[model samples]
Target: MKNLQPIISVESDAKMSKCRTLIMLISPTLVLAIIPIFLSFIIKKLILMTFLIFFGFSSLAMSASDIYFFIVILLKMRNNELFYQEDNKIYILKK
Candidate 1:
């Protein structure tokens, strides 16, 4: 008699890992916050340092969980990555 069994394999590529790392860093809130700062610098010549200080302080005031998520989104966006859902599975794609 011969034994028959199912073989399962997992393959992770650097590209996928990078995408995940990016997604973990850039959260939605961070993107929204950053947009205003960008506009302020573009339209009013406000100093970036000042905007950064204010952004940091405001983010710090949020709950730990919210802050974490916000940072995750920001990092992802900075890296030109985004997350999508398909068939209930989450996927990170590069832009």
Candidate 2:
């Protein structure tokens, strides 16, 4: 039988793990936030610009809150058993 488990590395150092997590969280948020600003520049319509600016700001706000909640969850889970979900199954990490 093929092993149908997700492999998660739990041996990474704390600093590196934090760095990786931040990058993952920030990169997409930055891209989404910046795209609207850039589009507003290329688009000369005032209405479009206003809409884009609003969208950009709202996305930034939502992303910030999402990142905050994600960090909170991580902190809360730090001492708990880590689990990974794949194909509707949850696998607990063995420390």
lDDT of each: 0.52, 0.61
lDDT of 2 by residue, 1-95 (tens): 57543343223323323334546556656787879978988999999999998998887876775478457646654443444445544344434
lDDT of 1 at 31: 62
Candidate 2 has what TM-score?
0.45
Residues 1-95, model 1: lDDT tens digits: 45432243223343334446444445434564655555555655457657765775565444355456556655554456655544425577776
Candidate 1, lDDT over the whole model: 0.52
Highest TM-score model number = 2
Best-fitting candidate, measured by lDDT?
A: 2
User: All candidates: CA RMSD in angstroms?
Assistant: 15.1, 8.7
Clashing residue pairs in candidate 2 (N, C-alpha, C atoms within 3 angstroms): none
Candidate 2 regions exceeding 4 Å error are: 1-16, 66-95
Residue 75 CA displacement from its true place in model 1, Å: 14
Model 1's C-alpha root-mean-square deviation from the true structure amounts to 15.1
